[model samples]
Target: MHAMNRRLSMFRSAVPLALLLVLLTAFHAAAERIQLDIASSGVRKLAVAVPSFANGSGNPNSAAGKDIARLVISGLEFHGFIQIVEGSTNGADYVVQGRYSSMGGQMMVEASLLDTAAGKTLPTRQFRGSAAQQDDLVLRLVDALVEDFTGEPGISRTSIAFVSDSTGSKEVYIADVLGRNVRQITRHNHLCVSPRFSIDGSKLAYSSYHRGNQNLYITDLNQNRTTKAISRREGMNLAPAFSPDGRTMIVTLSRDGSPDLYRMDMQGQILDRLTQGSGINVSPSFSPDGSQVAFVSDRSGKPQVYVMDIGSKRTRLLTLQGKENVEPSWSPKGDKIAYTSLTSGRYHIFTIPVGGGSPTRITSSYGDYESPTWSPDGKQIAFARKRNGQMELCIIHANGKGERTLFRLKGNQSYPRWSPRRN
Candidate 1:
């Protein structure tokens, strides 16, 4: 009996030792996978510094230099790829400084990127523009620095056009990625929805119900600033998507009483109907190669994602893990699709592969995240969420880290679209 009791005591000790080993191995594996995923997505941010830029226009310190610095800082923050350290902090990886030379009617600005520890300059560029063109100068310099660090063009110059109801009527407003230079693009006493950018970023096509019915209208941003109705069909014209070449648009129309996806030319002539009797298909997005289309459909008894071949008209379901998913936006790289899915009680943003895979949740604890729009580089996602009863624009890394608010507008903001890099 004594020997048996001793054996039992040893067994209990061995059991706990074995269990601890298993737990440690599992934890290590999880950490390894997380690191691998972050590296694969290139989502790790670099710590950099941007002190107050100096004025070189003989003023030594002017508001223009500060304004330029502020814009640059905002651009970097919005991109979410670099963390700007305070001037008081040290031991950073990189430091950026600037000198703004005011040229009377024009401004000449030079920005330099330096290695703080090594005390070496990484890259430098100078930009010149009229004083009235201050925004342009700052944007150009910022883009240069971005390319130096990330090897890709910055989104500072990219614009976002979305619907706003601040005027008591739904209208479209265009602003930079930093939410500055807000401009009212449309002032009609009508309702507009689904605003999209053309390939050249010179025109916007949206569905407006101002003329007693929903119709598609194109606003020319370059010439004459004119607006023309592109489609006056007998049914609801909405959800316009531009082709990669910008010569065609795939949209949803309910003229026949059922929402269906249709491909049309830039002139609104119907070229093909991609879906027929699909039970409310909408929000069609073309692939970057212009070979396939992804949209939302409820033919499966619930809203889910579907992709169709442009030529064969064959369809396949893309998302299976989520109960209901909608608002599919294909990334520019054509690798992933971002959409909103309801998990728990709040809506969260998720992304899945285009070829059908388990969806990865990107947002959590945020209030009703929706309408995720990918950046032109596919590195970050801009989305709208109602936090504290106010709609605001926020961005997060593609790998579900570095979540930050872009800015809070005066009124509610929704349906953000990040333009292609201008530089």
Candidate 2:
């Protein structure tokens, strides 16, 4: 009996030890990292090969297959982090291939990412939608592929809101990152500007002159597109910016005969006055932590950027070099603030550290850049550029490289506001 008891104790100890070993091995396998050098000059871009998707049904050279491949390539290249190259079987770090089929008015797509070094393909991801959703499905697949390669999802699903004059009047319009699904949000037919999204992206607030005054209004995007006036203070109600929590907004109101910043609830009830007659304070942007705000003020004789503490109400000047600075946008990472500065007779985009430092100019061209907006990941800046008497939308990397036109519309586009990352 003593020998039997000893054997039982030994077997129990060995079982736990074996289970631990299995768990450790599985963790190590799952934690393998993909080396992507996004910051190094040695490798400016990751070499990727995206061949034409194979058609599982219908014609082999179907337009649908070609369209899917084109969109996937465009979406990946738009981020400026990856370069889509040729030669699928050789000289590529990663390869993307997919198959598509259409049946009963529904389209299905299956795609896989291949690691050339490992000589293995990742598990296939499948998506199904109607024929009209072809572009959206390709965007989803590209986002997934980005995650597999960089461990961070791409911004293909995000959207941007801006003011355009396509309908012979300045109105707000929304479009995807790739400039598709363009929809006009307002049809005031007079003048509408400064379209700002709520933190949850379910609503948009702006000021319009259609009602014969600069009044503030909010539109419920999730509901049945109901629009309501939130503020009709009589002087100027413009540039509404939501806080990080979406409970309150900081807007420039001149109801009392002086333009100042006021924090108000969603119903336009004034919660507290942030700036008490501080020299035309406007364009408030909340920090990521909701502890501070960056805005533009002309209290010191010229327009300059300033940072203010919400708790103490202490303000500090941020831009010292530029004679005129406006439209301060706090970075999502809470480290920097991007704004527009006038230098050498032209408006340029510049970024300065949140804690006060020399501003670095991100735009150097002769065109005028204004109303800079940061992406959700804080990696890019979108702004309006005007040249040759035409205004258009442009984007530049945070590091000041890869400047390119974001979209080409019939009319001028200005005041771009990027949406937060979707679930």
Q: lDDT tens string, model 2, 288-382?
A: 99999988777887677899998899999988996567788999989999988777667789999999988899998778788889999788899
Model 2 has an lDDT value of 0.78
| TM per candidate | 0.86, 0.87
Q: Which parts of model 1 are misplaced by more than 4 Å?
A: 1-45, 57-60, 223-226
Clashes of 2: 0
Q: Which residue pairs in candidate 2 collide?
A: none
Each prediction's whole-model lDDT (CA): 0.74, 0.78
The regions of model 2 sitting more than 4 angstroms off are 1-42, 57-61, 86-90, 102-107, 128-132, 222-226
Candidate 1 lDDT over residue span 283-320, tens digit each: 78789999998887778866678899999999999987
lDDT of 1 at 132: 87
